[model samples]
Target: MQLPDKKFVPVMITPFNLKAKVDLDAVSRLVDFYLAAGVKGFFANCLSSEMYSISEDERLDLTRHIVRYVKGRAPIVATGSFGLTIEDKADFTQRIYDTGIDAVILITGHYANVDDDDDVLMRNFDRMLKLTGDIPLGLYECPAPYKRILSAPVFEKLVATNRFVYHKDTSIELEQVKAKLAIAKNDPNLEFYDAHTPNAMHSLQMGARGMSSISGNFYPEILVWMCNNASNPDKQEEVKWLQAELSAVDPAIHVAYPMSAKYFLRKRGLPVRTISRAHALELTPQQKQTLDEIYDRFTGWCDKLDITPVNVEELMKPLIHLDPPI
Candidate 1:
């Protein structure tokens, strides 16, 4: 499976039913929606997918299901390990690879108790790689439970091994991003994906490979459009405005977390329920009002990009329900 080009790769959410079970039906619809929207690829079983809340077996099953569902139309990268032990993590990673995903993403702090020590972390990483035997890997600087930002030297060291192919950079610091890009420049295998939407345009300008922001869950095509047009001298002004629009997404939708995202997806007509086991379902009236404004603004921006959102009826027509005998 080839990796997706430098474009919008969404860290996709697992759509659950009202009962909070893994809804394959919803998953099918979402895949179609993403494909229709021109997402370059998918990042599955990440924090947005509630990987921490899900059991190992469930994560494996879901990863396999999505791989099968996509049928290789786009490359797939998945969060492969969250195990406390190196052996366990390697085992899980091997299992995830067996499912035929293109690459595996590892949280930076997974095997370490202390984030300050680089040697310990690198040693643990090397040990895990030894067991997994040359499967491609990506790093996610996910800031949940805790954040372990990779230092420049350690990052260079890891990339030197050539096993690290993709990086989900969440440093949120432009200087650091620049430094990382410099390190990445010499290595063809290394590509950095900026997770910070506010810094996306600048990062792209600085030679980052692509985007892996939460906003892709809602407006992947817009992100794709921005990335494609960001370098055009004539499109500078238009791209600047869209950058602000993209940056505003985190504040509005991230406020409600995975819940707000699910709600927004439902609004876009994907068959997803707002049920998240990782977060509370409660949204205050004021929050709902804020969400409403965000939705309206989002729709306006979509129009500005000349992107039409898919409706539920359109997506569900192929499988329209049959009448139940009562």
Candidate 2:
């Protein structure tokens, strides 16, 4: 896919309703929430959005809605993957050219992962990037660490291309994360990000440009504020709050994200759903109940922290009514 020129504060979205529909209003609310809370922008249909389950039409509609809402207030780095063949992925890549978006975050899924020789995939990536028009790209490195971690050498080769651009380094290992950061330090043009929230301080210390994560989706101000003040004398106090917020929910993650997220926000009157219908990963009744209960306390924290609640529609307004970054 094409690469992005600017580095962004990207939040992964969650719009799963009961009918498995893409609620544009909820999406807008999320945009509004982040923009007001000081986020640069978002990556809709990303890992947090459960991209594997949504359809092409849905992705397009969502992007259009987001572009309309953002109205150039912030940059939007969308997703473009889900190809059966090289041409198929390329077709998807070219489709984004018309969407008024800045870049596409390319994930390494939907292709057959053959034994060690990933040359075929890389070649396909080259093709996809060429066909993706002139848009910049954001390489999504959220490889479940155990599943598709690319060698640092392979990563080096990819960034060799001037268009390889920015990267989101989500390899769970600290060394691998540090290796990517080290490489980025040498390449002044490359923008590197970390998604390992638990180790945010260590990451910033090691030279990650910033962080993009689901935790940011829940608490964007905290994440960005912490990064913006990583050098402050009160850094330890800031991290203490981040760690406490991070540990609020179960760390098993994957299946629990949407409900927990919506529950917490809804308790704050954000108007999101309390379930998931896309992936259809059914949570046990007891699990759902536990999520609701944790979110109950989450609401209390939000109240104490003075964080205002806003739904997706109200969040990402297409028009910049207030001061437009003069």
User: lDDT winner among the candidates?
Assistant: 1
**CA RMSD for every model?**
3.6, 6.7
lDDT values for all models: 0.82, 0.64
Model 2: runs farther than 4 Å from truth? 1-10, 16-18, 110-114, 142-146, 244-255, 281-326
lDDT of 1 by residue, 1-326 (tens): 33224677898898876677898877888888888877878899899999988899989999999999999999899988667688888989989989989999989878566545777888988898888888999998888767788888888988898898899999999999899899988898877899988988898888988888988887777788777777768778888999988786677778878888787776666667777888876767787677777778878987886767655567677764432211
lDDT of 2 by residue, 1-326 (tens): 32122222765566655576876777777777777767766676676775666778877777778888899998677777656776776677667636887777777544436354678657767777677666677677554222456568877777776665567777878899888777777777667777767766667667777777766656566566656655455456755665566555536333466655655555444546655654445556776576566555545555755555444445434533331221
**Model 2 — which ten-residue stretch has the worst lDDT?**
317-326
Candidate 1 Cα errors over 4 Å, as ranges:
1-5, 321-326
